[model samples]
Target chain A: DAGVTQSPTHLIKTRGQQVTLRCSPKSGHDTVSWYQQALGQGPQFIFQYYEEEERQRGNFPDRFSGHQFPNYSSELNVNALLLGDSALYLCASSFGVIRLGQFFGPGTRLTVL
Target chain B: AQTVTQSQPEMSVQEAETVTLSCTYDTSESDYYLFWYKQPPSRQMILVIRQEAYKQQNATENRFSVNFQKAAKSFSLKISDSQLGDAAMYFCAYRRRNAGGTSYGKLTFGQGTILTVHP
Candidate 1:
């Protein structure tokens, strides 16, 4: 059973540019959640996706959005990137909407210049 | 606006010793869950332990155990016989219970505690 997997372990983009980070959940998982962790801070909730639909979102602005595919994989898209957006974006997967013990990916370290 | 807070920004413990990291949370809802996640330099969030709001008994896994105080809204984690592998950033998180176990989970996390295990 493969654990959660994220692509483009590191990303660099200029301000105003857009970036997309990807995640594949562990097998048998159906829900995916995205989080942003700034340096020296814990991961902050971004949004959660289940059954290809966004179920809940955090205080993040419209600049942060996400999608969950039928296979339960997910992508986090950040638009109009600001230097503040430079952080580690983590994707966590669970077996269901109420599942505990979410498994997180290694995360994509985004650096916005 | 539920919030979780970890008072300790950094902590160090000698190998084979015991250490406790403190955590406190503020929430209006009575039903919820608390979690402790460890992130090492690799940055993979690993579930260390979890406690349910309804359960009075603390949760334990291996050498890790939690001191959950529902009335105080406090959840502290204790690691016994700590090893070098225990050194990591420990985050305290909260998730309100969702209907039917939908797992529509959104965690409110504290500004994590950095644990250093000296051998």
Candidate 2:
């Protein structure tokens, strides 16, 4: 009964560099979604992965991409990052696509210099 | 475009007291869901309570309850007998109902209200 887990509790990167954050969804869950929470702000939706393919995306640019493995784990990659990219990256998992309630992970704090 | 707003940026209540955090949203879609998530200092987002737009009865979880007004587009969370553990950043989020096709599960969130429970 493990909840959603994310790797690299914290990361530091410079502008124009790329970084990848990992997440393992809770057991019995198949859908994974990513979000970004800036300081003093709520999380903004990044994208969602289902069945190894991207199902939906938010207002993010092409630099932000994600992948879902067969085991339902996910990776969020940000390329050519900017200082504004520094934020808390959160991963959420749910049982299905239609499910509204999602279990969130502890999140990876990314710092872009 | 859907938008959620939490006017109260910070609030405090004495321990064992009651406090209500306000949230309002604007959406054209009639069917949707609203949620209240609690993020503690540890930064883990915990679901506090949720309400379905179609359900007239308010959703309640233990000491946490929501006052959902569909017409007014308001969703407020009321915490009774608040505890020190209740001190956290409370976020209000909204999601549209999945009719068909690709379900993104996208959630639009508000600015969040930081609740402080004074002991």
For this target, which candidate reaches the highest DockQ against the unseen true structure? 1
lDDT winner:
2
lDDT of 1 by residue, B1-119 (tens): 89999999999999999999999999999899899999999999998888888899999999999999999999999999999999999999999987675677788899999999999
lDDT of 1 by residue, A37-80 (tens): 99999899999998999988988999998898998999999999
- What TM-score between 0 and 1 does chain B of candidate 2 receive? 0.96
Question: If you assessed candidate 2 against the hidden native complex, which CAPRI class would it receive?
Answer: medium
TM-score of each: 0.98, 0.97
Residues B3-110, model 2: lDDT tens digits: 999999999999999999999999999999899999999999999898988899999899999999999999999999999999999999999988862345788999
Against the reference, the lDDT scores of all candidates come to 0.92, 0.93
Q: For candidate 1, please provide the TM-score of chain A on its own.
A: 0.96
Clashing pairs in 2: none
Candidate 2 per-residue C-alpha lDDT over A11-83 given as tens digits, one digit per residue, 9 for 90 to 100: 9999999999999999998889999999999999999998999988999999999999999999999999999
